[model samples]
Target: MKRANFIFICADQLRYDALSATGNRVAHTSNIDRIGARGATFHGHLTPNQICSPSRATMATGLYPRHHGLWRNGVALDERLPNLWQALSRAGYVTMGVGKLHFQPLLAAAEREMPESLAYWAKPGSERWRGPYFGFDAVELVMGEANESTRAGHYAAWLRRNHPEVVDLYEPEASPASRAEDLKEVWKSAVPPELHYTSWIADRAVDFIKHQSNRPEPFGLFVSFPDPHHPFAPPRPYCDLFRPERMPRPTIRAGELERMPAYLAEGDDPKKDPYIASGEQPREQGFLLRTDDISAQTLAIAIAHTHGMVQMIDDAVGRLLEALAGTGVLEDTYVLFTSDHGELLGDHGLLRKGPPPYRQLLQVPLVLCGPGIRPGTSLGALTSHIDLFATVASLLGLPAPATDGIDLKPLIEGRATAVRDFLFAEYHPRRDACLYNQSVITKDWRFTRYPNEPAWGELFDLSRDPWEHWNLFSESEFSSQAHRLNSILDQGLPPQPLIPNEVLGAY
Candidate 1:
């Protein structure tokens, strides 16, 4: 069998149900839906970590956060580890990476020499530097999430050099109407949709596909979009695509946090809290709107803005598909679409991600469309971001690297209905702090365990509480159920290292 060309597109902080095909009626994602139309969409797909860098590292190396040594967002992936891109390159494939490649710290100290750092890119000779980053033969990146002040990488340079007039338009406070005093994160950007970074990423990806189609070596292209991550600012036309009134109200059950961990509940001061003061648990600082303080209108605006960003990405995906088809490699290539992790768009009274392994932050979309893959099927078996590396190696006929993930090719080819019984995720935010969280999720249940606080944890019977509104960890009636899941969690935990990995920076 001939080795297949691969095109993997990833979104930053996209929810699983953000696409129209995923039953989101408010969002128009026709282009993304095409991938699902031509192939299979995996359900119960979760990220090993909720944040950007750790989850992306898992995808790149096929190892859990602990194994890969990127236990948090600010840390860098170990270069010595075998990554998917380098493996494909060794197998005679041309590897290309475009857009947000958050494999390194984006906001580290100036002396750290992090390539993804804004300060590094702003330096004099940084313009000429590109290639062999994280094993990609070539790369074009937008370092961090969409923020005007913090913009850097290849995209920022291009915008400044050619389209300087539109730089200020990228600011959240550019337009008066976009400035929502109540919700600082929600904004309608003044920059035109065509000039947006999402469009620029698509442009580069299309060019790469068009250019590579004429070459002999099979290509492995990763086009990662940074939109839909945060600071929900969509450019004009796309920004107005969804109305705030039409957006669904967030699912916030009254007094739901009381059942969960104490950190999740409001009116708890970090300075006063023993766990936080002792540096055992990281502080749960607000990420934009607080769950209890957010008004319905504010939440609606943020959701609508996020919907707009999704719509923009959908249109961009359409362009890439067209490029592939136009280059005559549509049938010869496998196109995989997924997100690094998900966002908490007002789910369970949470505004953004945190230590808790909630469904909203962990469950992301995974669509595999290509030859020999079952089309129009939805596989509900447990899956994780780590699986992609092994799956890709299998598709390319390369020796699968030593990885914690299983070969998902069997599930994709309809050879098996189930591959794994359970999925695992972890989050260790700070080295100094003991906020080590491990979660074991089965088809019927979701359980998160905080080792430091054995008495406080989360156990949700997915069958009954699909929304995860109720935490059944402390309930005596569900003690047996929690115990079984806790055992599974114990098996998933990796052995602690003798020397802890260095924390490069705070994310």
Candidate 2:
């Protein structure tokens, strides 16, 4: 076995633009920035299936959403596929997944959130909770990201119930108003508890690194953190870190809906306008879901609070780094920090995730730092999260497994390379009865196919319109480009596939 090990850190729903190294000013991510300075950073990284379960399954199997059959959340990954963890384990590597294994092995607790319409619906088996995930030696999970009301046997609650001092040593703070919406009862209750969830997870990781010794060889630890996801609840200090007045707001145009396809605005049951004009305040006329109750500054607080959550996550990352160094496993570990997907904070009149694929939820940040990696370098080539498994394999000198994701080692090593020419992502319920959306992105262009034929479809040139406000699907100039990208859609993708919606619009 190779003497080196791997430490992977994942931030839940962390946007690519939220990192200071990536030009996000409103927030701070010093630990991530330090890692970027030590190794290579891919600014163009993306998740083919940009959601929690699907993208994480992609990361595990090194397969595309089509190949893995985990194209949607709350669905099971095809059992037939051989994953990186399993392969590495067989090849004499110590593979231990530390956090957030979103793969749906069974329909029980952790996997319960998966919709029944998806395939391979079953309950989480003994292997789901028991260690050696696919191949990892140990796994202490925090039940697919939980809160007070929906505590799903997560690691934090486990620690709080048992080992609370670990948190005190690393993060001795109270997360005021960091509870779930349903847990508002506990939000204002007494002196806020000492250990927060994010820190608790990190504290457990530190203990695991220092104590766990069952592995016979070097380890590859998937240190996953389900932070900055939903609830937007960082503790009191972090929660109030940023003021909304200083944060930037979206620049909406009057003709925004005119450029977009009609179906995008079709789901407005309350008769709200599909698009909000520039300089106009957001109206609650069914334009968006999720953000049901909004006072004037509530939206602003949500934005600021989201950034605050990100900053809190940043501090947690620092603690993890300190643990790695303290454990005397610093140089021997190949560290990877990334997110399953980005969070769309008020982009496209959207609040939280699901229901659609906005840029705020699609584009994620990827920073890889360790031996043999170039520091502070950015690859302009487009990439996808499915490439993670293969990249890990390459770093360990293991053969790339049979999967749809491309091995990004060449691009990361500063080799100007040809990675994925065109990337595609899928979302919706995995079960047959549920509908979904498919998005195709090329270097310059993007096309989204909506299931159930919503209001309209979206097409944009990311190079020209990073905000993705312009819908160029109706433009005749890109007819050939659209066809060319569509041809590479991998017809023999994975196994059973989610049906792609036919868009009948102007172009």
Q: Model 2: residues >4 Å from true position, as ranges?
A: 78-80, 105-130, 144-150, 154-160, 163-194, 212-216, 257-293, 429-435, 451-456, 490-507
- lDDT of prediction 1: 0.79
lDDT of 2 by residue, 149-169 (tens): 123444544555576543332
The backbone clash count of each candidate, in order, is 0, 22
Residue 489 CA error for candidate 1 (Å)?
2.1
Clashes (candidate 2): 22
Candidate 1 lDDT over residue span 77-165, tens digit each? 77888999999888888899999888876556678777787668868978677888777998988866555423678888888889999
What shift in Å separates residue 291 of candidate 1 from its native position after superposition?
Answer: 2.3
Using all chains and alpha carbons, the TM-scores for the candidates as numbered come to 0.94, 0.79
The residue pairs in collision within model 1 are: none
Error of 1 at 407 (Å): 0.4
- The top-ranked prediction according to TM-score is 1
